[model samples]
Target: MYKVTVYVTYKDSVLDPQGEAVKGAVHRMGYDSVENIRIGKYFEIQVSKDEDDIEQVIEEICDKLLANVVMETYRYDIQEVEI
Candidate 1:
């Protein structure tokens, strides 16, 4: 078995409204040291395949379907899991 961790985040030029809201809240709560914040998504997938192959497939999926490369970036890592 393999476990995959996928992280999806906005591109540098993309606007992150949720992250901005969080930053505002943080500032209101007295954290003046906060500079900037960005919101992102996380996904965990279970796959039955060789690590290298699975990683390639997942990367393709991210590039083709799961993420918008112009506005967002995605990265994934795979780990073997004992059942």
Candidate 2:
């Protein structure tokens, strides 16, 4: 079995409204040392196949369907798991 983890986030040039809101809230709570913040998404997938090309297939899926390349950046890691 293999486990895949994906992280998706807005590009640096893009504005993150949710992150900004959280930052403002933190400041209102008397946390003045806080700096800029950014929000991201994470996904976990499990592939039952034992093929060697599974990683490649998962990458293709991330590029094509799972993530949007225009405004977001995505990275993934795959690891073999013991049953």
**TM-score for candidate 1, residues paired by index:** 0.89
The number of the candidate with the highest TM-score is 1
Cα error, candidate 1, residue 41 (Å) = 0.5
Candidate 2 lDDT tens digits, 1-83: 98889999999999999999999999999999999989999999898866779878887888898878888899888888987
Q: For every model shown, what is its TM-score relative to the native structure?
A: 0.89, 0.88
Query: Model 1 misses residue 68 by how many Å?
Result: 1.3
* Model 1 Cα lDDT, one tens digit per residue, 1-83: 99889999999888999999999999999998999999998989898865558867888878897788889998888888998
lDDT of 2 at 64: 91
Q: What is the lDDT of residue 73 in candidate 1?
A: 95
Model 2 Cα RMSD, 1 decimal: 1.3
How does residue 25 of candidate 2 score in lDDT? 97
TM-score of 2: 0.88
lDDT of 1: 0.88
